[model samples]
Target: MIEKYEDLNESYVTAGAGKDSTSIFYWGGYGTDQTGITNYDKVDGSDIRGYLKPESGSYNGTPNLSANITAWTNGALSDWNGKANSNVLKGVTTGDGPYTSYATIGHVLNTFLASADAKGYDDWYIPSCAQLALIFMNLTSVNNALSAIGGQQLSPSKAYWVSSEFDSNNGHRVYFKDGSVNGSSKGSRYSVRFIRDI
Candidate 1:
């Protein structure tokens, strides 16, 4: 059984364990950026209210990829706005499938968490790549809370999908084993842990 604790914060709830949950999902199809939305950076009181420009460039092994990842992971919380990124994907209808058709990860997440009986909240979303890194940085604390609540512990061997997209074909993900962020084909299957504002 999963139990909710107010003190546990967003990190705990986003660690892939909660009321009713699964371990893996696709990152979903591509979409345009969703601007002018209010989103949060950290579980703290910090708020970022604007649209973030979509990240550009090639996938892993690029000359500047490391720097880009570093900036994303260590930069402002606003750049890691998974909610807005997920919202963008949610509106997509040109490729893969539409969000309303339940053909993508965003749709699946909405169906799972938007219900009135779903963990007493309905705003859960796929974390951005940087957001996933933040969760990894606090893995110890997150795992502790999961243990307390009888939730599934995030595994180090697993790769988790994030809402950040690299292009129409690839999306970002984080490897828990080394906390490395990289881009992969959206069609690739990986673990997904939802996050929301507290």
Candidate 2:
């Protein structure tokens, strides 16, 4: 059965709660009020900082190696607001449309949206280059939690797409294998994963 966001409990909500069936991988806590406070330790839900990565199956589907970023707006090059980028690429429509037959940003965005909908949430979006770097920084802990839950761990051998665009013809991607960040042709296909704010 599909797991709903509400089904997650405190264990999953708190930052660095631990690895268990009920615990979700917490990246870190950031103060939502822009208080410039970032707590790497466990924090309660009241804190404005926290990011939750769903199970691998929930976001990472078959690698759409053919997916390109140039098929849609390149204006989503923000280093932080991936949701906005996704929204712009998806247009104002409620479902998939206007995407080319070949895998593209629109296709990937729609795929993520469908997964989010299945989880009874609608805020999931592609991670920006900065967000992807954050994930890389905490790869060990994230992988541990994923392993504990029988979820697929991030592969070091592959590069993953980010929402940041290098230009109209190129976009940024993170190489997990070596933690290298670079911009490549928008036509290049790479792995994708979605993240949501807590």
Candidate 3:
């Protein structure tokens, strides 16, 4: 069921999903740049639970992050954005896709996030591995909230991509398997899921 930002709230709580693992909120936050590389770096009050929308195309993760990639994360919490920006700075250029050939995840995901609109907000960005983990941590609740609108992945059968890079030739992903994270080739085709700041 398609929803508005006004709809997210505490009622979707699942176990182990809070700052203390015992509560829920309309939004939640984790991770920041200043905190270095910690998984759950909270930046004061970036309590934004991104507005996620599952898209229906597969993209390749190539062209590498060596091109002039652009990072869209600033004044936001996740370093994924900064890293993505840095990666884009390294990208050669941005263009259209069957991105399945040689375009990095940053090129595809960041471009999508930058233009996405959920409810009324537009400050969207990709989730870091840690931020993606948060979604996995609360999958049940996340699914519940999304279920109302015939949303995707109420029972996901595959992994979703993450914006974090493992190196110049690889990227990361997570899904419904015990939050098990792994790396894939940048040129490999994978599923796409976009999330926005709330």
RMSD (CA, Å), each prediction: 10.3, 16.4, 16.4
- Report residue 48 deviation for candidate 3 (angstroms): 29
Give lDDT tens digits, candidate 3, residues 1-198.
Answer: 222221122211221133222211101111112123233222212322222222322222321111111322321223455344324422422212322233333344333334323333444444665566556556677877776655655345556555554444445555443334555444454444456543
Give a tens-digit lDDT track for model 1, residues 140-177: 77777887876667776788777766555666676666
User: After superposing candidate 1, which stretches have Cα over 4 Å from the reference?
Assistant: 1-23, 30-78, 92-103
* Every candidate's lDDT: 0.52, 0.45, 0.38
In order of TM-score, best first, we have 1, 2, 3
RMSD of 1: 10.3
Cα lDDT tens digits for candidate 2, 65-88? 112222212222225666666565
Task: Give me candidate 2's TM-score against the actual structure.
Answer: 0.54
Residue 189's C-alpha lDDT in candidate 1? 61
lDDT order of candidates, top first: 1, 2, 3
